[model samples]
Target chain A: MLHAPASPQADLQSEPNDFSAILAEQTDRLLAQHVTPACLKAADGGVFPAAAWEAVSDAWLPLALVPEAAGGVGLDAPAAAQILRRSGYHALPAPLAETMLGLALWSAAGGAAVEGPVSLATGLLRLASGTILAEGTMAHVPWAGAAGHVLAIAEAPDGARHLALLPRAAYTIVPRRNLANEPRETLHIGTAPLGPDALLPLPAPLAGPDGLMLFGAFARAQQMAGAMERCLDLAVAYANERKQFGKPIGRFQAVQQMLAVAAGESAAAGAAAQVAAAAWNTDQFPLAVAIAKARCGEAAGKVAEICHQVHGAMGFTQEHVLHFITRRLWAWRDECGNDAHWQERIGRMVCAQGGAALWPRLVALRAAANGDRGTQP
Target chain B: MPDMRFATVAFPKDAEDLRLQVRRFLEAEKADGRFVPHRSSWNTFDPDFSRRAAKAGYVGLTLPEAYGGHARSSLARFVATEEMLAAGAPCGAHWIADRQSAPQILRHGTQVARDHIIPRICAGECYFGIGMSEPDSGSDLAAVRSKAVRGAGGWVLNGQKIWTTNAHRVHYLLALVRTGDAGADRHGGLTQFIIDMAAPGISVRPIHDLSGNHEFNEVFFTDHFVADDFVVGEVGDGWSMVTQELAFERSGPDRFMSDYRLLTELVDRIGPAPDARQAVETGRLVAHMGALMAMSGSVAALLDRDIVPNVEAALVKDVGTAFERDIPEVARRLVAVEASLDAQDDRFAEALADVALRAPSFTLRGGTREILRGVIARGLGLR
Candidate 1:
C-alpha cells in the first residue's frame, strides 16, 4: 500500500500539461486545517497566527522545495502557487508564502533550506550591484518579520540574477510602519556579507519580469478580497446602525443597491483571482496571471473606494476598523505588480501574440476569467 | 475550503476530476439511452432518468450521509449541474426537490417533510415545483394573491401560480400561500406548504414556450388542502427563506451554460485547421469561460464555508446568464448560417436558434436583469 510517488521525467513534462487538481487538493487541505479562525492583525506582527503557520507546515506547504529529491512536498512552481492561493483565501499571512519562495530559490541553487526557517524577498526592484534599494523595504512584507530567514532576489554584481538570503540575525531591524498598521519592519543591510547558508545554486534568473507582474497581480487581488470583506462588514454594520432621514439606510433601495454592487465587485475580483490562481497552478501561464492580477487589482481599488463612499463619514474615522482596512487596500494595490504594471505586461503579450489573433485570445481570457478552463459547455 | 469570498477559486478546475466520476456515472445513462440531455435542466421531466440519477446518488447532494445524500461539496454539485446542463440530462423529476424544496424542507419543513421527502428526492423518484408567481404578480413576488385559510385538517389554499414549471409532473409543490395579510411589509404572514399535486382541487394546464414545447404550466389551486405539518420554517419567514433560495438558484453553472451547445459547435466548426481569427475568437471565449468557472467555484467554496454569499452568488448568476447568452451571439458572429426556426441536425445551429429565442428571458427568469443589476450595484456600494 505504501509506494514511492512516481518521478517525473523532465522531457515528459509536456506529456501532461496539468497540475491544477493536485494543486487544488493540496490547497484544499491547507485551508481545511492549517489556517486559523482569525487573522493576524497588521500590528500582531502582520503575520498569521503561529498555529496557522504550523498548520501549513503540517500540510507540508513549506516543503515546496521543488528541486529537493528528499525535501518536503516535492511540488513544482505551479503546485506551490495553488497552495499559496488557498492560503490567501484564508488570509494565511505571508510567512508561509515567503518560506516556499525561499525554499524554491535555495533548491534551484542546490542548497537545502527547507529543513529550517527561511524567508524570501518579493517585488524586488534591483538597484545597482544587488545592494537593493526597494520600496518593499524588507518588513512591510505580507508576513515578513516572522519568517526565520529572508532571501532577497536581486541582480548580482556579474549582471546575472542571484537569490541572496539575508539571515534573521544579519541586519539591524527598523520599527514596523505601514498604512494598514499591519506588522512590517525595515532592515538596514549596509554591505553585509552574502553568507553561504543563505545562497541557492541557480545561475539564471529564478523568476522573470512576468513573474513579478503576475505575482503582484495575484497578491493585489487577494488583498482586494480582504478589503471587500471589510467593505461588506462596514456597510452591513452601518446600515444596521446609521439612520438617515429617519430610517435605517439599509431600508432605502439606493443604499441597499450600493452595498450590493460592492458585493458584486468583490465577486468579480475574487473571480479574477481564482482564474489566475488555477491557471498559474496548472499551466504556469504568465499571461493569465498578468490579466487576472490586473483586473483584480484595478477592480479591487475601485470596490474599496466605493465601499468607503457607501459608509459615508463614519468610514473615514481613525477609530473605526475601516481606516485600518482601507489603508491596507491603498498600499496593497500598489504592492504586487500594480495595475499599470500588469496592463503593460498584457499589452506586450497581446502585441507579441499578434494583433490578428490577440483579440480572440483576450476574449478567451475573459471567458477563462472565472476558472472555467473549458471544463464544460 | 479557502473561502470563495476572499479567494478567486474556479469550480471545474477544483471539482472536475471528481466531476468526471459523476460525469461517467451520468454518461453511462446517456450511453444506455436511459436519459437524454434535458431541454431545461431544472424543469424538464423524465421520471426514469430521475430514478436513475437518484440511484446514482445525485439528488439531495448536500444532505448528511445518514439522510442518503453523498455529502458532496457545493462545488461538486456545481460541476455536476454544468455537466448535466451541457449533456442536457433530463433531471426534472428531482430537480426542484434537489435544488430548493428539499433544502428548504431540511432547514425549515417539519421532520416529516425532511424524513419522507428528502430520501425520496435523493432516490430520484419524487419531484417538486415552486408555487410562486401569480398572473399579475410578475417580479415583485410579495404581491402574491394566493390565500391560505386555516381549516380543520390543516390549511386550505386558493390561488393560481403561473410559470409553475413541471407542475403537472412533480409530486409536490412548495406553495407560498398567504396565511394572513401583513400589509406594506408584505413579506409577512406567508407560509410555505408542501401541496400534493395529486390532491383534489388542483388543476394544471401546460404552457407552451417559444420553442413550441410544453415545459412550464399554469397551476390553479382551489381549496387545495395541506397539512399543518407541511408548513415550512416559521410563518412569515417565507420571504427571507425564499430570498435565501435565490442564492441556490442563481449561483450555479446553469446560469451561463444554457447555450453551451453553441460553444461546442463553434469549436467543432473550427476544427484542427483553424485560421488565426477562429483560433483567437475561440480562445477568447474559452478563456472567459475559465474565469467564469473560477468565479462559480468560489461561490461553491462559499457554500462549503456556510456563508450565504448572496451578493457574490447573485454576481455569478447575472454574469453567467450574460455569458451563456453571449455564446450564441459570439458564435453567430463567428459562423455563417441562415438563422431559422426549428433546430436542424447540427446541434450548434439548433442551440444558436434556441438561445436567440430564449436569451431574452434569461435574465427575466428567477430575477430580471434590472433587478439583478440593482442587487450588484447595491453590493458594490454604487447604488
Candidate 2:
C-alpha cells in the first residue's frame, strides 16, 4: 500500500496568523534580489535558469502547496497563490507556479511527495486495463522537458477518474515556448505503464475535468494581476522620468490620462484576482473564478497596450525591461483559457438560469460562499 | 510605484442580514405590483414608492437616529442600495436627498438646517438637486460666474444652473456660487447655499433628454434669497465641500448599475445554451461588471471609515461608467433586436433602446470622462 505522509491540514489550521502576507513579502524579497535583467535575458535566449530554480526550491516554494507533515511548508491556496503572484511580478523565467500546483495536485491525490520539479499536462488522459494512454497530443504542457514527472487527470473505462503520474520519458517532448519565453512544450504520450502507486483515484471534489481548467484559470488570473501591477509601476516611473515637452511627460494631461487608465485596469484586475483567490476553498468551484480569469485576461490586454503606448518607441525595443512583465501578461491571459472562452461559460450559466433568476443566483452564489442565507430580491 | 490602496472589505454579518430583509421588502413590492420593472432604474420617479420605502425604514439609512435615521453602517446602506437598483425600484424621488443631501446637511449644515430638513428628507417628503453645473462652466466647476452678494441678513444669489436632475421637482438646490474673487489659487472664494426652489426670483425650465424624459432641468436665479442658516459648511469653503460631495456621488453602485436592467434583459433574450459568440460577449460584460462591483464596494468601505477617497472614487466612476456604456453595445451585437422605446412586447428591444439613449449620459453626468481621468492622474501624483 502506498501510504501517504501525514497531511499538512492540521498544521495550517493551527497557525492563526495571516501566512499569505508573510509569504507574499518573502517571495517579493526573493525575486527582487535574484531575478535580474541578466537572468531574464539568458532565459529569453532559451537558456534555462537552473540556479534561479535552485534558489526558489531552496526557499521551499515547490513544497508551498503541500502539508507540512508531507515535508511541505503547509501554505494554503491563497498563500501559495500569493507566491505565484510575486513570481509573475518578477517575470521569473522558471516553472515555479507549475511545480507548486503539480506537487499539490499530486499530494492531494494521495501520491507520495516527490523531489524533482513537476509539470501538468493540459488535458485529461485515458485509463484502460490498469494502463494510462493519452487520447491526443497534450498541447502546451508547461516545462515538460525539465520536469521529472507530468501529472494529469485521467478517466477510466468505468468512468472513474484518477490522477495519473507519468515519468517524463513516457512521452515524447516537442519543445515550444510562449511569448514570455517560458517552456510550453507538447507531450506525445503513447501507451505508458503506470504502476498502482502512480495512480490514485481523483478526489471527489475535483472529479470533473473542469477542475483542472478552473485551477489553471485561477492561477493565471493571479499571475496576470501581479504582472499588471508591474506594468503600471514601470509606466508611471517612465512617465515621471522621461520629458518630451521640456517638463516630465507626466505633466502632460494625455500621458497622465493613459497612465490613469492603466492604473484603473490594474486595480480592477487585482481586485478580481483577490475575489477569485478567496473562493479557492469552495466546493462549487464558484463562478467568481470564471469572472476573475475573464476580467483579468481582458484587463491584461488593455494594460499592456496602454503601458506600451505610454512608454513610446523605447518600450517597443528589447533594451527595456517592461517587456519582461508585459510579455508574461500576454502569455498568461491566453494560457489557461482566453477571455472569450471563460466569458462564454459565464454567459451560458447566467442565461440558462433565466433573467428573473439572474440576480438571485448571483446573490445566492455569494451568500453560499460567505455562509449567509440567500436573499430573495 | 507606490502601492494603490484597495483593500478587500468583508461585510459584517449584520450587513449581509440586512440584504435578506431588503430583498424581502422588494419581493413584497413586486408581489403587490407596485410598479413595473421599468428601464429608467433610479431615474424612475414614483413618489408613492419612495414614501412606501421610507415608511419601511429604507430611507436615510446612514444618517443619525437624532435625525430620524437608522444610522446603519455604510456597508448596510450599500447592500440595501444595490438591492434597490437590482430590483429596478422607483427610488428616484428620494435618491438624491437620501444619498447626498441628507449626509451633507448632517456634516455641514447648521443646527437649524439639520433640524428642519433632515427629518423631512428621512421621511421622504423632501427632495434636493445638485446645483453645480452652469451654461458656461460644465466640467470647469471653478470657473463659475454665479455670484452671491451679502444682503441685509443673508445672501442674494444670481446664477443659472443647467442639467440639474429633478431640479423642477425637488424642493431645494444646494447651489455653489462665487462669493468672493478668484484668488491666486482659483479654488477659494466659493460658497454653498441651500436655496428654496419655490422662493421668489427662482424659475425652473424643464430640459427633456433625448429619450423625451423630463428628468433634467435648467434653473435660473436672479435674486434668490438664502438665509444665513442655509449656508453649508464655512463660507468660502464651497470648493472643497463640493469636491467632497462628488466623491460621494461618483463612488456608489449607481455609476455601474445604471444599465443593469439591459443586461438582465439581454440574458433573457439569449436564453440558456447561448452560442459561442453570445456566450463569449455576455461573459466578457459580466466579468467587467464583477470587477466594477468589487471596486465600488471597496469605495463604500473607505467612505464608511470617513476617509474621503477622491481618487479612488473617480477611478470607479470612470471605469464604471465605461462599463455601463458597453452593455448596450455588447447586447446589440449578441442578438439582433431593433431598438425602440415603444416596442411594447419586445422587452429586450425596449431595454436596448432605452439604454442606448441613456448610455451617452453615463459618462457625461456627475463628471465627464476627461475630468475623471484628470482627477485620477492627480491622485496618481502624475500632475
Candidate 3:
C-alpha cells in the first residue's frame, strides 16, 4: 500500500506561510544567539537577563499579535505561538510569551500598545470604586516584577468585569520563582488606583471566565511542546555521545528504547500543540486547549524524566545546560492548568456531552480548526 | 531525525460530505437492525454488510475507478473508514483488502494481477489475509523461510504461514516467500506472491484465540502453484514492499478504535452524569483519542501527498494501541461491573469482556509496541 518512494510533496498541508516561516526562523536564530547558558543560569538566580529581554523587546515581538493599525506586527495567533515555542526551545530567560499574550489581549480590549514586557494576572481579583482600590492578590504571576504592566480582569462590587492594565507602580510584587527560577511573583494591588485609561471593555474571547485560563493553557502547551522537543534532542545527543560498557549508550537497545519513547512523547506534544494553536479563536478553543495542555503537560514530565535519566548524574547538577530546558518543562507543565486540572475540565466537558456525542464533537473540532486556517477572527 | 512531524490535514469538502453520507448509512443500518453497535465492530465478519458498504461506494474508496472503485481522495477514504469504525460496523470481511491488500496490488501488482483481483476486492466479494508471520518469524520478518521456487509459468510455494488472520476463509493470501539467498542485510532475495486460497495444495487449520474466536489460522502450503501474474512488485524486493506499508497498517483509526465501543458503553452505563473519577478517566481517554485522531489524520494527509510518514506512523500506533489497551482497564474501574462474556444483557460488561480478551492483540498486531518504538528510535538516529 505504501509503494511510493519516500519523498516530500510540494502540496504540503501544514507548512506555515512564507511570512510566518521567515518570522519563526528569525525568532529561532535570535533565541539561539541570545539565550546562552550563562543567560539562563543568571536568570535562574533571580537576576533577569537584561540583554536578552532588550533584544526581544527591540524586535517588537511582544506586539506581534497586536493590530498593524495599532503600530504592531499584527501576526496571527499561530505565528505568535511559533515565537512562544521558540522561547521554550531556547529556555528563554524573559517573559516573552506572557508579554505577547498580554499585548494581544490588551490591544483586543481597545487598549493602546505598551513598551516593555507585560505579565498576565488571572485569579480572584476585585476592583473597588473611586480610587480604583483593588482587592485580592494574584499569585504566581509570571514576570510580575519585571513586566512594565499587568493585564487583568477584575470584577467591580456591582459585578461588572473590567479589563485593567495595572502599571508596576499600582501593584507590589512579592517576588517568587517557579521550579526553573523564572519570576512567578505574587502581586498585591496598591490602594492607589490606576489612571482613568487603565480600564477597557472586555473582549468577547475574554468575556468568559475560562477565557484567560484557556489562553494560558494554550500558550503553556505550545511552550511545553517546544521544551519537550529540546529534552528529546538533548537526550538523543547524550545517548549518542555518552559511552557505556564498550560503545555509545545509543547502541544499547535499552537506552535506545527509552529515548524512543521520549521521542514519541515529544512528537505527540508537538501535534497536540499544533491542534490547540489551530483551534485558537475558534469555538473549538476551549476543548482543544484543554486537550493540548493535558497532553503536553503529561508528555513534559516523561520527556524530562527520560532526558535526566539519559544524562545520568551529569544532568542533575546545576552545571549542565539540560536542566535549563527540563526545569522549565517541569515548571511550565504546572503553570496554566496542569495535566490533572485540564484533564478534569476535559472530563467534565466530555461527560456533559455524553459518550455518543464524543466522536461528532471531536470531528467538528477538526473541521473547525481546519476551516479556520490562517484567518484571524 | 527522519522528520518525525505530523502536519495537520484539512479534509476537503468532498471528504467532509462523505463523512455525513457514511454516518447516515451506518445509522440506517443500525435502525434496520443490520448490526448491533454494541456487539459488532470492524473485526466482526459480516460479508453481507461488507457488500452493502461496497455498494455504497465506501469499500474501495481511493482506488482507481477502472477497477470498480470510487477513486476518492485518501481523506475521503479516511472519513468513511473512521465513520464505519465509529459506528461499530462489522467490516471485517473487506477490511484488510480494502485498507492494504488492494491498495498494495494497485501500486505494485502485475497488470494481470490488478485486473483479476482488485475489482473483486472492490466488490467486497473477494477477501484477503496477510501472510507475513511464520512459525519462526513473527516480529523478525526477515527470518521468513517460506520459499517459492520457479516452476512452470510461475512459482511453486511450499511453506507454512502461522497466525494468518482469516486465511481459512479469505480468497487470497499475500504471502512473502524466499526466492533466493538471504543477503548481508537479511532483507534481500525475498518476493511477495498472491496465494489463491482455493487453489490446490493448501490447507488451513483454525487457531482459537483466548476468546474462543477463530479469527487466526495456521496455513500449510504444499507446493501451491502461483502464476507469474500474481507476483507483487519485483522479485527480491518483498522486504521493502512490506516495510513500506507499515505506516498505512499502523497509522489508521483501527489501531486506536479497536475497543471504542467499550468506551461508548462505559459512558452510557455511567449515564450522562458520571462521578468525578469516571469523568476524569473517560475524559483523559477522550483527550488521548482526539490527539490520536489528529495524528492519524495528519498521517493520512501525508500519504495523500505521497510523503511516507514512517516514524510519525510508528508514534501514532505506539500511543494509539496503548490507548486502545487502556479502554477496558479504565472501564472496569469507572463502573463496578464484573467483566464477563456471559453477561449478554449487560452491554457494557459484554463489550468490556470482549475487549479485555482482545486487548493483548491491540499492541501485538500491526507492530508490537517495542518494535514500533525501535522504528521510531531508528528515525531518531538512536540505532
Worst 10 residues of 3 chain A by lDDT: A1-10
- Cα lDDT tens digits, model 3, A1-377, are 10111211222234524444566678888888889988888888888888988888888877777766777776656667778887888899888888888887787777876876888877756877843866568898899888889888877888877788888888787888899888889988777777888888777777765757777887889888888877888888888899979899998888888988888777777877878877777888788888889889888999899889999999999898999999889999998777888887877777777778888998987776565433233
Q: What is the C-alpha RMSD of each candidate to the true structure, in Å?
A: 10.9, 4.3, 3.9
Please state the error at residue A140 of candidate 2 in Å. Answer: 0.9
| Candidate 1 chain A, poorest ten consecutive residues by summed lDDT | A368-377
> Model 2: residues >4 Å from true position, as ranges?
A1-23, A68-71, A131-136, A190-192, A283-286, A364-377
DockQ-better candidate, 2 vs 3: 3
Per-candidate TM equals 0.62, 0.93, 0.96
- Give lDDT tens digits, candidate 1, residues B1-383: 11335344433454557566666887687788775342344445788877877777667678777778878777777667766766667766787788878878888888877887878788887888888788988788888888988799688888899998888778898877778776687788887888899889899999998877676899998988888788898876788888888888777767776666566656665554555556555555554455566677667777766778777677887767767777777778878876565455665566567667777767778787657867665554433
Docking class of 3: medium
Predicted structure 3: lDDT: 0.84
Worst 10 residues of 3 chain B by lDDT: B1-10
Ranking by lDDT: 3, 2, 1
lDDT of 2 by residue, B21-115 (tens): 98899989989988666555898877888888888888999999998899899988988998998888888989999988889889999999999
lDDT minimum window of 10 residues, candidate 2 chain A: A368-377
What DockQ results do all the predictions give, each relative to the true complex?
0.11, 0.56, 0.59
